[model samples]
Target: MYYADAAADNSVTAYDLSSGSRTVLCNMHVQELTLYQEKLYFTCTDGEKRTIYRMNLDGSDLESLASCEDLWYMTIYKDVIYYVNYENDQYAILSMKLDGTESRILRKYNASDLCIAEDKIFFAERDTRYLYSMNLDGSDVQQLNSTYSRCINYMNGQLYYYGSEENGRNVYSCDLNGNVTGKYTSGAKFLMLMEEELYYYDWDDVLHILPLNKKSEEENTSHGTNIVSYKQEDVLKPVRSYLASNWAGYTLDEGNITKQGNTWIILLSESGGSRQYQLIIDLTTGKITILCTTEDILPVSVYLYDTAPSVSPSAAQLSEEELNSIADTWYEQNYGPGGAWCFEYHDYDGNGTYEAFAVCGPVMGDGYDIDPYNILEAILYISSTGEITVIEKDVRDTDFCVENEIEKEYYIEYDGKGYYVPHFRSGGILWQPMYGVKDNKPYDTGISGHISLDNDGDLLYTPNSGIFMCPECNNHVEHKHILAYDETSGELKSAVKYPSGEIVN
Candidate 1:
C-alpha cells in the first residue's frame, strides 16, 4: 500500500502489507497522496507554486499535473482527481483529469473529508453534524446524516466513520441509504480506512487498528478529507519574510508566496476574499522590492491537449505590449480601475483552443477602512480567435449590470459557464446549475444545509461571499458578515463577524 511519510524530508512511502517492508517512493513535502491506475498523484511545493505531480508507483517518470492556488484533500474518482483548490479569499472543490485537463470548480464553499461511497464521493462537513455525498462532476450533493463525523470512508456497501459526540468518540457504520447498520469500536479517533482494518488513535495518541471485510480495489478509496483554516503554511521562507513586512499597511499573512527563478510572486489576501492582490516581487536587488503587477496570477491547469492549433500564432508573435493592451482594455471596461491584474494564455477550458484569462480586481483595504462598491472582481476570457467572454456570475448589481434579473446573471451562453451558483432570492435560496452537472437529481428542503443536487425543485443556495453592499442603504459592510450560512439549516442566515471576533446580525 502507498502512503505519506512526512516526519522529516516528506516522502511517499510504500509498505508491503504482507512482508512489512518499507520503501520511499518520492521525497517532496507531499499532501493528498493518491494512487490510481498504477500512477501516484500527490501535491508539493516548487517554491513558486503549489503543484500537483504524477508518477509511477515504482517512482519513475514523475510529471506535473496542475498548479492550483492551494489544495487540501484530493481523491481519484474514475481516473479524475477531485481536489479542494484554495483561492485568494475562498475555497472551491475542483475536478480535473489525472494529467490536469478539463478543470472545473464544483463548489464555492469549503469541502471536507472527501472519499467515495457507493459510486459517489462522500465526505465530512466541517463545523457540522453531517456527512455529505456528491457525484464526480460536483453535482448531486446531499447530507448523509446528523453524524458529526471527524473522519470517514466507505467499504463493502457500508459507510464507516469515526465521529465525536458530547460523551466521547465512537465508530459507526451505516448503509448507503443512511440507515444505522451497527456501531463499531468506541472512544477511538479514526485515522484511516484500510482494506480490512480500521486505523485509529486513543486518547494518548497511540495508533491501533481493527480488521474488517475486504473491499475490491480499496486503494482507490479516500478517507477523512479535511480542510483546515487554509493558510499558506508551506510557503518558502524568503517569501514568508517578505509577506511578514505587511505591505501598504495591509497584512499579507495567509497568502500564497512562491519563488520563480529570481522573482517572487505573491497572491495575497487580508481576510480570505475581502482584500485580494497579486504582486511580483523582485529579488535581483540586495533588498526585495515590488517589480510589476500584471503577469500570470490566476491559478490554472496545464494539460497535454493544451497545445494550440496551426492558426495560433507562435510564442514570439504575440508581443507583450499587444497582449497587455488587450488585457488592460478588458479590465478597465468590465472590471474597474485602480486594481491589480494578471493574465495567462492557456487552454484553461480544455477545449483545445488557447484563451487568455485576465483576472483583475481592486486592492483590499486594511481592517479599519471600508471598501468602495466600485470594486468588482472579474475574470475575462479572450480566445486566440479574438473572441471575448466573461465568466457568468450571479453577483450584486455593482454597476449597470444588474438593471434586469436576466442581466443580473452577467453571462452569455457562448463560454465561461460558471456552474452551481447559489442565488438568494426573495422567496428562498436556489442553486443555478446552468450546465455540466448531473441532471438526474432533484433539489428540495430535505437536502437543506447540503451542497448536493437533487430534482426536488427547492431553492438550493450557498453563501455568496463577495463584495456585497446594502442595496437599499448603499453602505459598505464587513465581508465576513456579508455571507454567513447557518451550518445546520442551510438558510441564508443574516449574521456578521467583526475583526474582534464579535458577532452581529
Candidate 2:
C-alpha cells in the first residue's frame, strides 16, 4: 500500500508491508502526490514554474515527466501517470507513459479532488456540483449522478466516498456502474479503511475504529482507533519567539504567496495607526525580512496591496527582436496612413501567423469649417517596412455650443493637429458618443436594493420586492443602472441596477 504525507514536506513514503520496513520515496514541497508500480510521482516547484517528477520506490532515478507551470496531483496505473494541468483558469487532465512518452490529455474540467479506478477516472467539479467519470483516454466523460461527493477511494470494485448533506457528514458506497448501495456511516468527519476496520478521526480529535461488516449495528462496530497514548503536556510545546511573531497584527493576501529557488515566500502586511509595513517570510528557514514601510506621509492605501513579483528570465536568454522587427515592418506597410493605417496591432492572428489587429486614426489638415478645426488625422499602418504617416491640422474647440445652444463642451487639440470631443452618456462624458459612457458615476444604490430586469423592458428594484419583470432577457449588461438598445433591431437588450447595495443583473 502507498500513502502520501502532505502535512509535512509534501513527501510520499512507501513501505514494504511484508517486511514492515519503510523508506522516504519522494520528497518535495508539492501540493499533490500519488504512487504506482513501485514508483513515486509528485508535483514540485522549479523556480516560478510547477512541474511533475517521477522516481522509483526507493527514491532513485528521479526524472521529469512534464513541464507546466500549473501541474498538480498524480495517479499512476499500469504504465501511465495521470495528472491535472491548470492554466488560463482552466483544468485539463493529462496522462503520460512511465518514461514520459506518449503524453495525452484525457479531459478538461473545472475540477478538484481526483481519483482513478480500473480504466475510469473520477473527479469533483465545483461548477456542476457533481462527481464525474471518464475513460482513461478522455472518451465517455459524463457526470455519474447528482450526488455531491469528495475524498473518493476505489478498492475491491467498490467506490467509497464522503460528502456533507443537510443533516451531517455521510459516507456512501457505490459500484463501478454508478449504482448507490447505501450509507456506510453518518456524522463521521475523517473515515478510512485499514485492515478490516474503518478508522476515523472524530470532530473532537478522538480516533475511532469500526468493523466494515454491513450487517452489524452501527453503534456496535465503533471503538477508539488511537492505539498510542500521551500525557497532555507531552503533546504541547512552548511557543517560540519566531513562531509567536506570526500572530502579530499582520494581514496576508493572495499574491503574498510565491516560490523562489527551493523555498516559498510569503509577505505579511503590518498596520499601525496610519502607517503600514511589509515583512517577507522564507519558508525554508522560517526567517523574516522586512521589505518596506509606508509612513503617515505616504498614502497607506497606495502601498497596502500585495503583488507577486515577476521572475525574470536569465540575462543570457536570446531576445526575440528579429521576430518583432519582422512583425513591425509588416504592420507598418499594410496599415499605414494613406492606406489602412488606422489601427494598432493588438494580438497575433488566429492562425498565429501575423498580427490580429492594429490601432489606426484619421489624418488632419489646416483649420477650416470643412476641416472642422483643421486637426491632424492618424491611421493604423501595416506593411513589410516600418513607417508612420500623419495628416496635421488644428481641431480644438474651447468655446463650444450644444444643439445651437450655449452649453458646456470639452475639447482638446493633440499633436498640434488633432482634436478631442466629449459627450455625455452614462459612465462619463467622452470625446465622442461612440465611446459610450464615462467611468465617474456612483456605483452604489443609496437605498441598499437589488435590481432585476427582463426581455419585455420590465425593471425591478428590491429590498423585499417581488419579480417586477415578466420574462426579462438581457443581451449585455454593465454595472447596475445602465441600459442600452440594439441599434440594428431597435430593441432594448441591456440594463443594470443595484440590489442590496450590490450590483446585479
Candidate 3:
C-alpha cells in the first residue's frame, strides 16, 4: 500500500504488510496523495514553490502537473484533479484535467480532507471545521454534520471521517447528507480502508489494523470491555506512568479502557475530580496522546438537547467601544487596511470574560454576506487580563446576517451539560452552518435531518438531490410526502408513502 507520511516530511512511502517491508517512493515534503489509473499523484514543496507531481508506481517518469505558492490537499475524479490553492492568503478550490488543462477555481474557501465519491465532492472547511458536500463542479454546497471532521474515507455506500467532538477524535459513519449513523474505534488520524481490513493511524502516529470482515453485531463485542490482554498492559503502563509523572494528580481511569485491536483508548481524571482527559495509547510503540480534556465530568447528555441555554450579561471591565477597538486593530493587522469588519461581545459560556465575534469582509459592509468574493470571520476570546486568543478564523457565520432574523444555535458540552455556542446567521437564505465550542476552541457542527421545500412544493434534499419517493407508481406525487433518511444505510425513503403507495419502508 502507498501512503503519504505527513509527519515524516510528507514522504510518500509504500508498505508491504505481508512481507513486513517498506520502501520510500518520494523523499520530499509530500502533502497530498492519491492514485489515478496507474499513476501516483501528490503535491510537494519544490524549491521556492509547491507543485503537484505525478509518477509511476515504481517512482519513474516523474513529471510536474501544476505549481503554486501553497496547496493544501487534492483528489482526483474522472480524470480531473481537484485541489485547494492557498496562494495570496486565500483558499481557492480549483480543478483541472489530468494534463493540467482547463484549470479554474471552483470556490473561494479554505478546504481540507478533500475526497470525491458517489459523483459528489466532500471536504472539511477549515474555517468552521465541519464536513461539507458539494456537486462535482463545486456547486450546491451542503454542510453534512457538526463534528470537526477530516481524513474522510468512503466505503460501502457510507462516508466515514475522523470526527473531533468534546470527547475525542473518533471515526464516525454518516450518510451523504451528514446524519451520523454509528461510531467505530476512537483516536484516528489517516484512515485507509482495504478489502478485508481497515488500516488507520492512532493519535500516537502508530499504525493499526481493524478487521472489516467482522460482522456488524460483533463490532461492539470486538472493541468493548474485552479483557485486557498481556499485550494491552504494555501499552497502558507507559500512559499511566506518563500521566502520573507529568500530570501530578491525574491518574488513569482503568474502567474506561477500550481495546481497538493494537490500540487502547483510556481515560484519566484529576485527583480532585475537577478535570478529566481522554487518551489513546499505541500498543507497539507504547506512545500516548490526550484526545480531549474536560472539567468536572464528561458531557454525556449534551447531544439530547437542541436549544441553547441563555446567558445573563454581567458588568464588564472593558467597555463595548474598547472591545471594538481591539477587534478592529486585530482585523487591520491580520488582513490589512481597506477592509470593513464588525464585532459583537458575548459571554458564550457564561464566563465573566466575554469573547468577541469579529466578522470582516473586503466590501464596506457589516454582515457576513458582505462580499461573495471573500470570506472573513473570527471568534476572539478575551481573557480577564485583556489577552486575545483567536479561537477560530475564516468562518462565514450566519448569525451576523443583517437582512434577516436568523436564529442559529451553537453548543458545547461540559460536565455532563451542554451550553449553546453563539454564531451569526442570515435566516434560511444563506449558509447557516452551526458551530460548537469546547476547551475554548470553536468547531463547525454541521446541519442534519431537516429538509426544505421549494415554492413549487418540490422536495429539496441538500446532500443528495436525486433522493425521492413515490406515493404511487404513477399516482399523484406531491411534496407533502416527507422523506425519511436512513443514516445506517445512507438511503432516503418516504416517511408516509412507499415506492408503490404501500405503508412499508
Query: Looking at candidate 2, what is the lDDT of residue 170?
Result: 57
Assess each prediction's global lDDT (C-alpha) against the native: 0.51, 0.45, 0.59
What is candidate 1's lDDT per residue for 244-263, written digit by digit as tens? 54443444533455744223
Residue 282 lDDT, candidate 1, scale 0-100: 25
After TM-score superposition, what is the CA distance of residue 276 in candidate 2 from its true location, in Å? 47
Residue 469 accuracy (lDDT) in model 1: 48
The alpha-carbon lDDT assigned to residue 172 of candidate 1 equals 74
Candidate 3 lDDT trough over 10 residues, lowest sum: 301-310
Candidate 3: where are CA atoms >4 Å away?
1-29, 217-505
User: How do these models rank on lDDT, best leading?
Assistant: 3, 1, 2
Model 1 TM-score, 2 decimals: 0.40
What stretches of model 2 exceed 4 Å from their correct place?
1-8, 11-27, 30-33, 165-167, 187-210, 213-505
Each candidate: RMSD: 24.3, 23.6, 18.3
Candidate 2 displacement at residue 177 in angstroms: 3.2
Per-residue CA lDDT of model 2 for 263-362, tens digit only, reads: 2334445545443444443221122344446542211111110111122111111123422443345334433432122222321212222221122222
